[model samples]
Target: MKAKPCENILGLAMGSEQSRLRQQLVAASMGMVTTHVLGVCVQLKICDLLRDEPLAISELARVTGTQPEPLRELLIILASLDVVTIEEEAVALKPSGRLLLADQTGNVVQWVQYAAEFCAPAWMELADVLLGIPPAAGSKRRIYDALSSKRYPAEIFHGAMQDTQVEISATLAEAIRLNPGEVVADLGAGQSSFLIELLMRYPNTSAIAFDRFSDFTAMKQLAHAQGVAGRLQTIRGSFLDPLPFRVDVIVFKNVLADWSMEHLKRILTMARQGLNPDGRMYIATTFVHDPPSPDEAVVSLNLRVLTEGGDRSEVDYVAIAKEAGFELTRQERVAAIMILEFSLKGTA
Candidate 1:
């Protein structure tokens, strides 16, 4: 067989592209070491300590109760990652490093910490799980399943989720309008970030927060902190079961992505029956194909490891909603999160 000249050129180009992709994969694999480095720094409060000002390695090690030489090596790795800057013998936080401060409302430190400690183990065995390998490590469960079974504290898992949700609470609060006396319910309200924001923004409004009892302690604390405690009602149960009461608006903020499609449909169906005559449901989640795609891809993979579920498209949600006798009324994208509005088939 004789190959055409253009075919040979095309084959060479394809081969070159595949080689480049392989090199990129190798580079990405190296990022795991950096991830663990950042995880160690966060676990040791290194970033929090450096947030105020530059600190000498010796002082930082002393304060964090870490050995100096090992701490210095970690700091050097952080400097290489641009998380911190090394000047003379002191290390100071870079702008990006400020986000790791423990007190920062929306921080990635806990998220990274949770991933390194909990998710990474399961992620390492993902191929085993996918291949249905026998229980070498005992019955393998996804990260959320582990949390659900009380294998890991819910506080750590939910805290990590709240770390990210804090950034979008304000934006989500603005995406919906509430009349002075309208009622709202947040299904699976992990920390009540959304409910608290709504109550704060619309002083005349009241909210129902439903989740496990363990998750409500933080919600109560958050509501008290936000000075909206009196306006908030806490319900303890799984949203998978029927909601006890109805509301004028029901919210599934940042929750649907963690649910399987069957579960999503069941929840939406319950939301349908749980709504008042003129009620609406707002579903806020990171949709499948939003902008700044690299982060989205990473988040999707993480969610998949945790729940065996990840981001889904508008079409997917709409179809699920329609099956549940609801219709998609509107969708608004704020930051990387998408807020989808649904109404009963006959309602506006």
Candidate 2:
């Protein structure tokens, strides 16, 4: 039987819509499983083991203390995800999987670990949080407080931050120019990777790394390893308080976005106080766009909201800086990061 044209068109549209919905459902299901599978692989150091060479499934199980059959099943799933390649019975890391190797500089293993352990649990409480109900297990403290109080693993958290910041810092180091003797300060510097990069690039310039809960020992070790220890100084203090030293350049990298407007204003005022009259301040962060785009920055904004902070737009940032007695001189976008250069009202 020949169907009428409108009926055939409607039927085709319905079929297409059904297929789309089915794909969405399948993807959602796979996403959940993939996160857990990757987490288990990281915990077992599977990527690290496969770094040097591929190993037979049985041998991998023997070394990682797992049942060979179950390990093989996991590897099959990893292969489906394009994270690993399975040849006969041997498993090898693909490029994506190699990014999880522990020794790789700026590797995302720590971030993945933290997300699996901490963020996943917190996200389960999203419904309750949206309803104004506190999480069942802990006080209503912010994520930063939990980190500062040692309730969460601070080292892993900071390592995750360092991992994410590595590329951004490198890009920033290349973008901003420094005079031979200019001094820079990195506020809320986690491991001071940015300052270390800057010092490496500008050999004659020195830097100060300031953060209240900074791992000075680890920072020193990293700086020494990079041969920048002699040029970097670590300070332990809150940015809300008066800064102890004045500098030619002050930077807040992925720092200011973690505070409220009131706190941002206060912190910027403190930065103004700590800047030399002719000094410049650079803020490197991810800004929310005026008309939101469906991207990772939006996902980051949601995470910040969960942590009791929120990302701001350039308009909001400029207004906040003005209120704190600074003027935005220039702005630049590098990948997902935004760099806002500011100076005192009349200094620029």
RMSD of each candidate relative to the true structure: 7.9, 6.6
Off by over 4 Å in 2: 1-20, 52-59, 67-70, 87-90, 128-141, 216-222, 334-336
TM-score of candidate 1 on Cα atoms, chains taken together: 0.79
The lDDT for every candidate, in the order shown, is 0.77, 0.79
Q: Per-residue CA lDDT of candidate 2, range 1-348, in tens?
A: 432112232223335777656655555544546667888999999998999899999999999999998899888878876778899998999988887887786577878877776676666666765676654446432677777787777777777778667767877787788999999999989874788778988999999999888676678887999999989998989999999999999998877777778989999999999999999998887756756677855465545534655677777788999999899999998777788899999988
Residue 321 C-alpha lDDT in model 1: 90
lDDT of 1 by residue, 257-316 (tens): 877898988988888888998889888776566553888887776666666567787778
Judged by lDDT against the true structure, how good is candidate 1? 0.77
Clashing pairs in 2: none
| Model 2 lowest lDDT segment of ten | 2-11
Index of the highest-lDDT prediction: 2
